[model samples]
Target: MPARRRQQGPRRLEEFAFINLIKRRFGRVPRRVAMGIGDDAAVVRGPSTRDWVVTTDLLAEDVHFSLDTTSFDDLGYKAAAANLSDIAAMGGSPTYLLIALAIPTTLSQSDLSRLYQGLHRACRPHHVALIGGDTSSSRAGLFLTITLIGEIARGRAVLRSGARPGDLLYVSGTLGESQAGLMLLGKALTRGIRRGLAPADRARLIGRHRRPTPRVALGEALASRRLATAMIDLSDGLSGDLAHLCEESRVGALLDRSALPLSPALRRFAALAGSSAESLALQGGEDYELLFTLSPRHEAAVQRLGRQLRVPVTNIGRMMPARFGMKERDRHGSLKDLAVTSYRHFT
Candidate 1:
């Protein structure tokens, strides 16, 4: 019989090279992890005075994003930011991260390098450590998954089930800009048109879509102060996420349409695109803003916290009994059923 050929191959070499690239890029190991990338398994310190907050998110090509309108770095940064926003919603401090990627041959190593660099840029502020992960080639488009580990003082982590009736609902930062950006990009980038908007406006809207800021500090502040009754991050649009929070708490919400935060760029874009900013703010997804509920009494304290954090906080509505169902007050002083157009996975 002929001897079996050796398993050594160029594929193995390419994977090793990628590993080395990651090692060189993220070589600095945080004290929390005794071992990080370049190991069979990572060793992380156990929580002592705090509880761990864990979250995982999967981003698939063409579904979660379209490579035609997105860059590799934007993809990585958004993936990390999404996970961070999850931790933020729970009022936890991000510490460690693990990434699993199913890359396609179309993406080059330099593309991946930029992707990792974007991830690092987003996580460095939180001092999150890249512990370990798995990598494999995919026959289809790229797939990226991130598992983030965070810590919160024991029993201090906020949940989406603590909201009570009459509690005020709040959100940090403006909304709808992301959806506006996506619409503009899809229409303009795909067709090579950038007319009717200033360069700054275009950049602002696009930036909101490509990279979102996680309200970690505000979340921590709200949690540590015991202010927020229940909280959630607006990844799936305000109406949708609020619905999720209301469902979990067995309560309902009444939103003030006029109170919905709309960025200047979004307002301008809406005018140019002949669309309503209010609709985008209500139905737009991937804002990554924190939507939280707190008692009416704590409204003042929350305002102070927002100022201290320098984050724009708006009281958009209040919670109601489940029997009331979800509703919103229109601009003409009328109430209507809240329409949730949030992004759904299966649909």
Candidate 2:
């Protein structure tokens, strides 16, 4: 999974910094890889013709979700989708999935079945198989950890380190709706009263959060055409994920606020909630959209590719030199530093 780093936090070792510590402590673990530690997935040398892309994600009850807002079916589907998004980021086709679950004894068998149904539904379209997994009883709540394996042509895995200073930054699909959906799911704190929303809008926003689509076809298309210079999925929101990409590639980014994609539902929700859609677009997590960089000259080809795939790819920013850091131009033509307020586990 991509790192969920927040801009502000208490006195503690941050997630990525902790990751770096692990990398240093276990630096001699003797694992051969094409890429490791810092990207969406770890690429390992596999067969003569292809390489393996592997990633894992863990979702804990209360910490990641609650039975109050999420159903068993939606939970299972989102878990699978999250892992699939990782493979999408690596530009690989998912092959197998293994789930390790710590289930509470109180959960009914029917609920468990619904969970598995969700997992199956997500994997079926991509032709991926649930090879094997482990189950154990938990005194606490449910804890699910999924490990996914994927494959790509040898030496063809796209990475976060490939972005250059001049590459254009693009994202597929609209942003911020998932976050809006999550807000609607919970008791939204708007002037200490529940705001009435249209039934259709409510359903749409909730669905976005519950069932995010992994951009498998878009990722494959970009990889096959050699279009993207660097790629990442928007799991941790645009601000943090883009920061991760810039840090890895030693580049910076300048975002055009007007270019940020906003869905109509999100705009309406933002207005009702007394917030801006742009804030939600930048700070919301689990959007699962792909953020990639492309050279300026290939813009036309990518636009055509987006049309062919039926995925809207928007050019929202441009990569810049590292010294410039990450900044954004507001709609009013004012420049300011882009703050990363995405979800972070410890914060």
Candidate 3:
């Protein structure tokens, strides 16, 4: 007798079939499978000589982006970039990715191909392969979930911990540009509805919103060279992400407002938006730059590395005694308690 089809809902059978196939092919149970289908990426053992690094990120329509505002190619690129940044945070080299996409049946074949084209663009530079994936139709908007696997030398993978008192806090690249770009795009989109904007400006702001760069090479360089003591990615804004690094290290920090890098365009955008550059620098998210801590001894080396990589490394602050409090020093040298926060899922 043939087995009856399970009526557990669409794709449930497919999901089970996939899981069973993996178990059957791999034979031995997955060790260090820190994660699997349900939550995020599946984490398995790294090479005997290395520590494993794993991360996952989800991209959804409307919440994360809008098709009306972004190109499908850029959307795919940014989605992969986001996950690659996570692996970069651990100072690891991305190896492979498993993609799971849910899209509406209405999507055309060309649209799907364009999305994959974006994914390929982002993955190729990092030498990341799309080894496997699953696809399904959804009644709602498009969704993409990527699981990234990376590897680092044994006991050398950087983590949020390991920061100590007096270590310097640094960030690669300027802040607020992404947010400024966002604001600009939003305005342009609204204006485009009425009068539209110049082709150049529209293209610039739209590009920023659609595609973002991930500092993977810089992260690996910092790790392999032992430049940063602790590190994390700036996906959630500088203030909030800095707090994460400090919290993990059981330390606090003092950010210098004047030291932050702001682009001229971002400055104009912030001004138009009735916000300050400092505010945007502190709270703007999705920068995808590296926010890290390093000992004073490595400062020179870090600078040299930055020059080699052609990326700026700004020393914005230093780790402080937790009891001293997290504060920001203004241009006048006035110290005020800094309320560290960032964009959250629920918020």
Candidate 4:
């Protein structure tokens, strides 16, 4: 579920930050540990044979979000939600969170409280605890970081390399809506003109862009039922994200363009932006939905999961032999090569 974070040259970090990064990276985990650095989090052995899932995420001012289109409350909410999504992708239950922030001189005390308030709002429902974190002054805009600790049953954490040739690719909820929402928040001149939209529609689009929900419950359900062979969160676009999974599994895939799950909001927004819905759904990042693959035999079970969770799940394609290559088939029955169209943060 971890997205590819684009890094600049060498990064200068605080002493503790440096230690955490280096230790977590090069330090060897004990025999009891389940995983390290490769999966959603560093899963270690917990009490009573439970597995501990730990992950950290960052949200920089201009790099991840801008104040122009986002509020402090949503910013705090989204930062926590991003880390929560990582736990969800791992089929773990989020239990504790540590928030670190680099505050700017431009913000007031009241504003800072509102930010924490938003974080609390997100954690209350999931029963996640706010442990502690460090605070620092920033010369630039706000920089936020979150470290989430979660738990799952031992040996139950799903990975992205289990996908096989006959496994069917499935995605939870709709795609492209988040990107379409971001487009609406961009420049008015660049976004183009559209009319006859209701207030609710505008709110829906903007909300999707600002705040997104993590599929935690559904993730646990999928893992508990042994429904998914491989699972990953859609932080990057489906195009590049799926390629990462395929590469890890040593397989190829075929995406059915006609079966892509898109929303009415996406169609309407694409028409206004003079772009196609499929392109947005394929390349748009930050949707935060679950994309996993399962065997064809589980088709009936997947349908049941969809209904039980009240989450719309779509079978977009199937895994193929590596020699066949990763490609997409259009509704017109045309086969085309698929490209890694995901956004690179550094670029």
TM-score of each: 0.94, 0.84, 0.82, 0.84
* Candidate 2 deviant stretches above 4 angstroms: 1-47, 190-196, 344-347
In candidate 1, clashing pairs total 0
Top-lDDT structure, candidate number: 1
Q: CA lDDT, every prediction?
A: 0.87, 0.81, 0.76, 0.77
Candidate 2: residue 98 Cα off by (Å) = 0.5
List of clashing residue pairs for candidate 4: none
lDDT of 4 by residue, 212-315 (tens): 88889988888878889888888888998899889888889999999999888777777766789999899988788999999898889988988988999999
Ranking by TM-score: 1, 2, 4, 3
Candidate 1, residues 1-347, lDDT tens digits: the string is: 00111213545566677667766776678786877766567889887889999999898988898888888888888889999999999999999888888778888888888989888878889988888777777889899889999999999999999999999999999998888778777754333335877889999988998899999999989998999999999988999999999999999999999999998888888888777889989998999999999999999999999999999999999999999999999989899999988764211
Q: Give the lowest summed-lDDT range of ten residues in model 4.
A: 1-10
lDDT tens digits, residue span 226-342, model 2: 999999999889999999999999999999988999988788888888888998999899999999999999999999998998999999999999999999999898889999887
The number of the candidate with the highest TM-score is 1
lDDT ranking, best first: 1, 2, 4, 3
Q: Which run of 10 residues does model 1 get worst, by summed lDDT?
A: 1-10
Candidate 4 residue runs with Cα over 4 Å from true position:
1-46, 188-196, 344-347
lDDT of 2 at 199: 70
lDDT of prediction 3: 0.76
